[model samples]
Target: MRLFSLRTLLVCTALASCLGMVGAQAATKAQPAPKPSGQKVAMLGGKFAFTLPKDYVKGPMEEIDAKARAAGVTGSLYMNKPAKRVVIITETPLPNDQKVGANDKPTLDGIIADTLQQQQSSYKDFKKLGEKKIVRKGLGMRQLDISGSVDGGRVLSTTITAAYGKRTAMVNVISLAKDAKAHAEVVKGVTGGK
Candidate 1:
């Protein structure tokens, strides 16, 4: 088993990044993968399963994204066109040397910093809204919030990352700033907030 890398996590959210910008830039030139027909997504051989919101149809969906192949990243993307919202779930194996332990505050901090920097560079007018640590379903997770400009619109995003064995899973929820309330609900749903 292995651990996840920064590159892998980045690939996981590229869709939300690019699509949020209305293709202001291409994060990866990956060819489109078959679209998933259902909103229910099963990953890691069904070890993890999530049912997305009704309107969030799967994205140029793929079992493994080509651009992220070398990094051992696999993901599923869901897009809610009517609301211009996106949800991305990514799983990646981290190298043994880079394994992140549950109490690895330093490692988690570095990851949060790197992810924030990546988002800042990817989105214009970027601002760090807030961040916090949360435990959901007995899993330790770090949640981050940020706002940035994309496609002449401001987008708000929340990312929740957790370590599972040698692999890491990252889930990102993105929406236009005008839809922050809905976006918060979406994030809360994933984080199991009341």
Candidate 2:
């Protein structure tokens, strides 16, 4: 067994604290992944791909699409179900305008926060697993874990938000009528950042 010196102990504790702070900073700070702003590429298991909203940012070229695929979700739909419908939304960070200040928040982050707030109206069961810092497609990102139910069914939701310069995205994954744990697992797998 190796001896434990006071200096060594202090160093280890300091390192652990620094690591924790880094994680916390990463969780709240902006990420580095560029949103898919240009050509609409096939995403997630070849289910579908169309021109994203010009204002919308894009995810990393790789797993962002892959995560969408695993979620078994397709393009955004115009209609909403009356009794019960599972809603999934994904957002990517857009390029920033140089005129804007760095302190400006990403649009996608706003969207996700809005969606979560709106969910308060319809969802009976609401719980947040909190936020985590993640890396997707070699870019820094944030993964938010949310759980709840709408129309008497379970919903497992995950949002991957990326901030590239002035833009940010919140990729949402919502599931229905299934075990919350299982649903979250699927969503994480689909988003490709978990």
Q: What is the C-alpha lDDT of each candidate?
A: 0.65, 0.39
lDDT of 1 by residue, 54-149 (tens): 667676545455666677777767777666677878777744536655545665565677777777777778899999887654566788999887
Q: Please give the lDDT score for candidate 1.
A: 0.65
* Model 1 TM-score on a 0 to 1 scale: 0.73
The root-mean-square deviation over C-alpha atoms between each candidate and the true structure, in angstroms, is: 7.4, 20.2
Per model, state how many residue pairs clash. Answer: 5, 6
Best by lDDT: 1
Candidate 2: clashing pairs of residues:
35-58, 36-58, 44-65, 44-69, 67-190, 67-191
The true-versus-predicted C-alpha distance at residue 190 of model 2, in Å, is 4.3
Worst 10 residues of 2 by lDDT: 1-10
Q: In model 2, what is the error at residue 178, expressed in angstroms? A: 2.7
Candidate no. 2 TM-score = 0.41
Question: TM-score for each prediction?
Answer: 0.73, 0.41
Candidate 1: list runs displaced more than 4 Å: 1-50, 61-67, 96-104
lDDT of 2 by residue, 1-194 (tens): 01112112222232233234343443332222223343343332232233322333332222224554453322332111221112233332233332222223454355446545554544467787677655555445556676665444355555554444433333444433343443454344445533
